[model samples]
Each structure stands twice: as structure tokens, then as C-alpha cells.
Target: MKPVEIAKGVYDVGVIDWNIRDFHGYSTHLGTSYNAFLIVDEKIALIDTVKKGFAEQLLRNISTIIDPGKIDMVISNHTEMDHSGSLPYIMDKIGIQKPLYCSKMGEKNLSRHFSSDLNYQVLKEGDEISLGSKTLTFIETRMLHWPDSMFTYLKEDKILFSSDAFGQHYAGHEEFDDVVGNKIMFHAQKYYANILLLYAPLILKLVEKITKAGLEFNIICPDHGVLWRNPGRIIEAYAKWSKQEDCADKAVIVYDTMWDSTHQMALAVADGLHENGIDVRPMKLRDWDRSDIMTEVLDAKAVIIGSPTLNNGIFPTIADFITYMKGLKPKNKIGAAFGSFGWSGESVKIIEQNLGEMNFDLPVSGLKIPFVPDNNGLEKCREFGSQLAKAIKG
Candidate 1:
């Protein structure tokens, strides 16, 4: 696809990889792109670069418009190899002594990956760099996804160079969010649920900081996805997402079973929840995706976890799910656990232990069916559902 002029002097030179099926082992079922931007002010600047293997193509794309040597500033928004891996080669090819810019943490990461001698000009929070015609202002957004993360704003254009925040793994030549439509929202949720969910508090702080800074951004150029022309839409949406608040009247029940006994118990619980006018999505851990469940939990008010005992422990898949949830820190929700065990009957306790370690304020209600779940045990599962619903409602 031809590189398109996204706005005046702002070009979307990032490539579309329809052939790519996965990104860093995360299944990008809808494909993705590495978004890079070029800003032409008095001193031309390349905000970020692309992958190392695509160095040749990246240069060729830049060559079509302007002399690579004339690029006066290079900003490394993220030190993730995907974004900054080509910096060494790009600098060598252009014979550029122009300073590479990033946070101090980003500089450390760059040194580790490339070499100690790789020249970098580090900026702290609220630092500014003059581009002759326009000024680039920095805002340190630590742990939005990485400690080294940051955003740059062009004073003249009101454009925010957000590295990963508001980014998606969507691959397309379309430069605008309105053009991308539903895919933008879908991939945004996928990206947020998997990557930025845990840092919701930081994100909320960032929103407040940006507003308090009075940075009027009309354009948003993110690192890995489409640029935003309608800045308010994204900003308003971010305001809600960063609050760790649910957006739905639904619940997600994630369970893993052995020998169909625990599975039966899960189904009984789901039936009872549905009977109580709750929208229940009962998922089996065998093929349930952690990221998918994360997206579900992002909007869910209640959650139910289940696993069958395996060697006096919770099932491995269930364990992995809890680990992911804990890392993502899905807050502002009520949750509980259930399982079936033969001997030790420790699966529920283990699940509770994991939840407690994550500092989740889970209401005290967990269940474990002894041996096999019979009709009587099914009643217990239904009762657990009732307790969970009551907690969620309260």
C-alpha cells in the first residue's frame, strides 16, 4: 500500500502486513501493523522507526519524500525491539549525528539492546524539544505498558505522539479511526485488556495530568495502530476505561473440569445465574483464551472461577488463568471460586490463596464438591451462584 499523507506534513508511512498472523507470539487473528510517523517542521523529524528486518523498506519509503540525512531529530517512543530495533542501522545509513531522544529508562533499555555507545538524548517528564517551527513536549507515562513509556505533543499541531497508549495491533493502510470503524474498537479492547488493564490507575492519572497540562491535542499518532483525528472520542472513552469500572450487565463464569463432574457443577451454577436474570457466559478453560476472558472481565461485574483437583492442586489451565487475571488486576468486581476434589480438597483453598495474594477483595464464598458432583452437590453449586450474585449486586 502507498504511504498516505495523514494530515498536513504528517504522513502515515507505516506498512500493512496482511501476511502476518501473529505478533510476538500473541495471536493477531485480525493482523497488525507497526505505525511510524514523519513530521515536517522547520527541522524534519521521524518520531519512531520500524522493525529491523524492514530497515531497507523503511528507508526506501522515507527516500521517496525527503533526504534521510536531512532528518534532524529521531524520537524513540518505545524501546521495544519492534519500534527501536532499526535505530542503529538507520543512524548509520543516514550518517546522522542528530540526537536520538527517549526517557532515561528508555536510554538504559536501548543501551542494553544495542550498545553502550549508542548516542541518546534522554528527557524527563514535561521536557520539551524545539523543532524550529513546532515544539515537541514530553510526558512520562510510566507503566502504561512499560516503565519507559511516554507521549510527545507537537505544540503547533496539537498532535500527541502516544507511543503505545491508544494503540491497537490492527494492520491497515486506512489512517483514521473513523475509517477503521468497529475494528478500531475491537482491537483497542484486545490491546487494552491484554496489555494496559493492570495500569488503569496510572492511565487515570495520565488523563488527569494531560487535562491539567492543558495540552490541546487534535491529532493522536500512536505507535502500533491508526492515528486519531477525532481526539475527543478517544479521550472520553479513555476516561471511562481507566477507571476500572464495568460497562456491562453481564457476568463471566470461567471453569475447568475433569471427568465432567466439575463441568456439570459449572453448568448448574450458570443455569441458576441465568434464572436470576443475569447474563452468564460460561467458558471452559480447555480452549478459553485468557485474553478473551480478560476482555470479558473488563466489562463484567461478577466472575466465577472453577477447577478440578489435580494432585491436590488446582488444574494448570485454571492456575494460568488466575495468574493472568492477577497480573491484569481486574478491579472493581466481585468474584468467587469452585472446584471438585477427591482427596485433599485443597483446590478451592488454593484458588482463594491466589486471589488473596493478588489483593482482590473477594467475598468469602467458595465451593468444592467431594469426589463427584451428584444432584445434591449441584444444589450447592446453585447456592454458590446465589451468593456470588448477591455479592455482585451489593
Candidate 2:
């Protein structure tokens, strides 16, 4: 993709990573983009850079609009490799002595990332820099996802170049929120659930602080995915997601079966949930991506997990999913465990212990079946699911 002029004299010179399917651990079925912006004024500034592999492509995109050497300054909003991997090459191309601005933590992280001795200017909260007609104000958003993260606001254009707060791992021809319509919210929610859910408290506080400070934005340019032409939509979403209060009457049943026993139990449980007027999602562990299961877990009021015992422990896939989910620290959820076992029936107890560690409300005791769950055992599973539904409704 060529350089897109997001605003007058401001270009999105980032490279789209259309082939990337996995971001660290999160699934990017639609791929993603590494967005970098170039602001041209009497003094030109480049905000962030693409990944290391795309350094030449970033320079080429910048050259399409202006010579890379003409860029007077480079801004490091975050020290993550995806956004700052090309810093060394960019500085070499522009000038070794050019000013590179970043947060105090950003400077430290960049120094650690690269051994080169480059110009590093540290900025704090409420710091402002002049770029000819445009004035950029810095807002420190530490731990929004990273310690080095910050936001650069172009006062003249009312555009907030957010580092990664409202980003989605999606790559497509559409570059703006208005063009993608409501479909983009799913990707954004998935990103939050998988990446930022652990920092929900911080996000709520940050949004409140920004609101009280009377900061306004006409556009929000994140380092990934489409730009938000209507910034309020995303701001409102962040507020809601951060709160984690608006959960639906939905249950996600995740299970892995060795002899189709746990699978049948999962289906029976789903039926029970649906009969009780609860939306249910029965996901087979091997069939669904962990990231996708987490996305479903975000808005679910209850999470029911089932797995067959193996080697006196829960299934390996079940353990993997539990680790992933616990690390995200989902809130306001009711959890239950169920499984089938031949001799050592420890999977349900192990799952229950893990859920307890996450502080999930275990409304019902775990259900365990021996060998294959006969009709009576399946009925017991359905009753367990119904009991969980009642707890969720309460």
C-alpha cells in the first residue's frame, strides 16, 4: 500500500503486514498493520517506525511524500519492536545526530534495545514541541500496554497519535473506522481481551483522567489497524470494556475429550444453558484458537471448562488454555469445571483449583464422570449447567 495522507501534510507511511497470522500469542486471522506516521511541516517529524523487516519499505513510503533525509526528528511513542524496530536504520538514513524524542522510560528501553549511541531527548507529561504550524503535546500513558507508551497530540489538527490504546490486529483496504463500520469493534475487543484485559483498572483511570483534563480528539491514529475518524466511539468502548460490567447472559463451554465423553457432556451442558434462556458457545479446545476463546470469554458471564484426565492431570490443551485465561485475569465471571476420568479423576478438581486462584465465583461444585458419561451422567451435566445459569442470572 502507498502512503495515505490521513490528514493534510500528515501521512500514514506505515507498512501493512497482511500475512502475519499470530501476534506473539493473539490470533490475527485478518492479519495486521504496522502503522507509522510522517508529519510534514517547516520541521518534519516521523512518529514511530515499522518493524525491522519493513525498514526499507517505511523509508520508501516516506520518500514517496518527502525525502527521508529531510525528516528532522523522530518520535518514539513506544519501545516495542513493532513500533520502534526501524529506529536505528531510520536514524542512520536521516542523520545520526537528529533528535529522537521519547518518554523517560522509552529512552531507557530504546537504549537497551539498540547498543548504538544516538541522540535521546526525554519528555514528560504535558510536554509540548513545535513543528512549524503544528504543536505536539505529549501525554504519558504508562502501562496502557507498555511502560514506554505515550500519546502525541497534534493540537492544530486535533489528532491524537495514540500508540496502541485503541488498536486492533486487522489488516485490510479500509483505513478508517467509518469505512469498516461496526465490524471493526470485534477485532478491537479481541485485542483488548487478549492483550489489555489485565490492565483494565489502569485503563479506566486513564480514561477518567483524560476526560477530566478536557482533551479532545478529531482522529485517533493507533500503531495498528484503521484510524478512528470518530474517536468518541472508541473512547466509549474503552470506558465500557475497562469497567467489565456490561456482560451478557452468555456462557462459554470449553472442553477437550479423549473418548468423546467430555464432548458429549459439553453439548448437553450447552443445551441446558440454551434451555434456560442463556446464550451458549461450546468450543472444542482443539478446534478453536485460544485467542478466539478468550474473545468469547470477555463478554460471557460464565465459563465452563471440561477436560479428560491424562497422566493423573488435566489434558495438556486444557492446562494451556487455563494458563492463558488466568494470565488475562477476567473479572465478574462465574466458573465451573467438569470432566471424565477412567481411574484417577483429577481433572475437575485441578480446573476448580485454577479457577479459584483466578477468583472466579464457583457457584457449583465440579462434576466428574467415570469412563463414558451414560444418559444419567449427561443429565447430571445438564443440571450442572442449569445451576450455573441460575447463578449467572443472579
Candidate 3:
């Protein structure tokens, strides 16, 4: 990706990872971009760097506008390797003697990542640095996702350089929110569902703090995906998502079947949910990615999981999905568990326990069937779904 000027002298000097389909464990069907910005004032500053492998691309992008050595300061917004992986390389290419600015925790984190000693200037919330005409304000956003996370605000430009907040794992030609249109929010929602869901409370507090601070932003540029030209769109989204409210009267049935028994139960559950005037989605574990399923769970009022027991335990796929969902910590959900077992029918019990740990309102004990579910067992599953739907409506 070429360096595109987002503001008067602020350029997006970042690299696109169009082929990266997986980020950690999150599925990135649309890939992603490691966005870094270069602010050219009387004193040039580079805010964050790309991934390690994309160091050359970052350098080339910076070279398009000015010499790497000309950058007076380097700001490390987040010490996560994705954003700071190329920091050492960049500091080496430019002069290592140049002042490196970061949050207090960012200094410690980045120091551990690189062995070399360099200039480290630690800043905290309410700190401001001058670059001739423009002033850079730092807001310490610790634990939005990481301890070292923070945001840099270009006071002159009214652009908030949000390190990882409001970022999406999407790779596209468009660099601005207006250019990308509606598709941008899909990726943003998925990102918030998977990566930032656990940090929702902190996000809410942070957004409130930003509002209380009266920090108005014209543009919000994150360390990934496209920049938000309409900054409020994502801020409003963050506010809504963080509240853990506004769920639909919908249910999501996630299941995995060794035989057809659990599959039949899932279908019956979906049918019962639909019969009760609830929007239901039955997702086969083998067919749906865990991240995608978590995204569905984000706004759904109920999550019903089914699994065929395997060796006295829940199916591995079900275990995988439950573990993944447990970490994301989606709130305001009701849940039910269903399963079929040949000998030991512990799958439903275990699923119930996991969902309970996530604070899902489980009104009924799980339904377990022995061997392949007969018509009677399938009917039980349908009853369970109807009961869950009634609980959701109430």
C-alpha cells in the first residue's frame, strides 16, 4: 500500500497483509492491514510501525514522503508485536539515537521485545509533545487490550491515532471509512466481538473518559484496517457493544455431531425456536469458524450448544468452541446445552458448566440422550428450545 495523506501532512504509511487469513486464532477472511502513520510537521514523527516482515514496506512508504532519518521522533502506541514488531528495524534504519516515545508500560514492554538500549521517553495521560505547529496529546488507554496500549491525538489535525481500538482485520484498497462504505462495520463488529469483547467494560469506561475529557476528533486512525473519517460511527459502536445490551430476540444453536443424533437434535431445536417466533441460526461446528460463531453470539439473546459425547466428554469441536467463547466473554445471554452419548452422557453437563462460568442465564438443566436420539429424544430437544425461547422473551 502506498502512503496516502489522510490529513494535511499526516500520511498513512502502513502495509497490507492481504494473504493473512488467520490472526492468532481469529479468522481473517478479509485479511488485514498493519496501519502506521507518518506525521510530517516541522519535526517529522512516525506513529507506530508495521509487522516485522513488512518492515521494508513501511520504509518504502515512509521514503515516498521523506527520508527515514528525517523522522525526529518515533511513538510506540502499543507494544504488541503486530504494531511494534518492526520498531527495532526502524530504529536501526533511522538513527537509534532519535527519541522514542511511549506510554510508561510501553517502555517496559518494548524494552523486553528488543535487547538494544535506546532513547525511551515515557509519557502518561494528559502529556503533550510539540512538533512545531502541531501538538501531540497522549491518552493512556491501558488494558483496552494490553497494558501498553494508548492513543495519540494530533491536536492541530483533530485526528486521534487509536492504537488498536476500533481496528478491523480487513485488507482492502480503501483506506478511509467513507470509501469502504457499509462493509467496514461488518469487519469492525467481528473484530470487537472476537478481540475486544473481553475488554468491553474498559472500553466503555475509556469512551466515557474521552467524552468527559472533551477530546473531539475529526478523524480516528487505528493501527489496523481503514481510518475512520466519521469517527463517531465507531465510537458509537464501541459504546453500544461495550454496554453488553441491545440483543435481538434471537437464538444461535451451535452444535457438533459424531453421528446424526446430535445433528437431529440441533435441527429440532432450531425448528422449535422458529415456531416460537424467534430468529434462530443452527450452525454446524465443522462448517462454522469459532470466531464467526462468537460474532453471532454477540447480539443474540440466547446461545444453545449441542454436542455428541466422545469418550466420556464433549466433542472436541464443542470443547474448542466453548473454550473460545468463554475467553471472549459475551454478556447478556441465556443458554442451554444438549447432547447424545453412547455410554457416558457428560457432554451436556460439561457444556452447561462452561456456559454457566460465562454467566449465561441457564434456566434449565441440560438435556442428554443415550445412543442415537429417537423421536422421543428429539422431541425433548425441541421442548428444551421452546423453553429457552420463552425464557429469552420473558
Instruction: List the candidates' TM-scores in order.
Output: 0.92, 0.99, 0.97
How does candidate 1 score on lDDT? Answer: 0.80
* Candidate with more favorable, higher TM-score: 1 or 2: 2
Instruction: Write the number of the candidate with greater TM-score, choosing between 2 and 3.
Output: 2
* TM-score computed on alpha carbons, candidate 1: 0.92
For candidate 2, lDDT tens digit of each residue in 250-346?
9999999999999989999898888899999999989999999999999999999999999999999999999999889999889999999999999
- Model 3 has an lDDT value of 0.90
lDDT of each: 0.80, 0.93, 0.90
Off by over 4 Å in 2: none
lDDT tens readout by residue for model 3, 1-394? 7899988899999999999988998899989999999999899999999898999989998999999989999999999999988898999899889989999899898888895487999998889999999999999888879998999999988999999999999899998899999988989999999989999999999988989989889999999899998999999999998898978899999999987888998999898888998999999989988888888888899999999888889899998888888888888899999988888788888899899899999997888888877888888888888888899899
Question: Could you tell me the lDDT of residue 336 within candidate 1?
Answer: 75
Where model 3 places Cα greater than 4 Å from the true spot, the runs are: none
By summed lDDT, which 10 consecutive residues of candidate 1 come out lowest?
Answer: 18-27
Error of 2 at 306 (Å): 0.7
Best by lDDT: 2
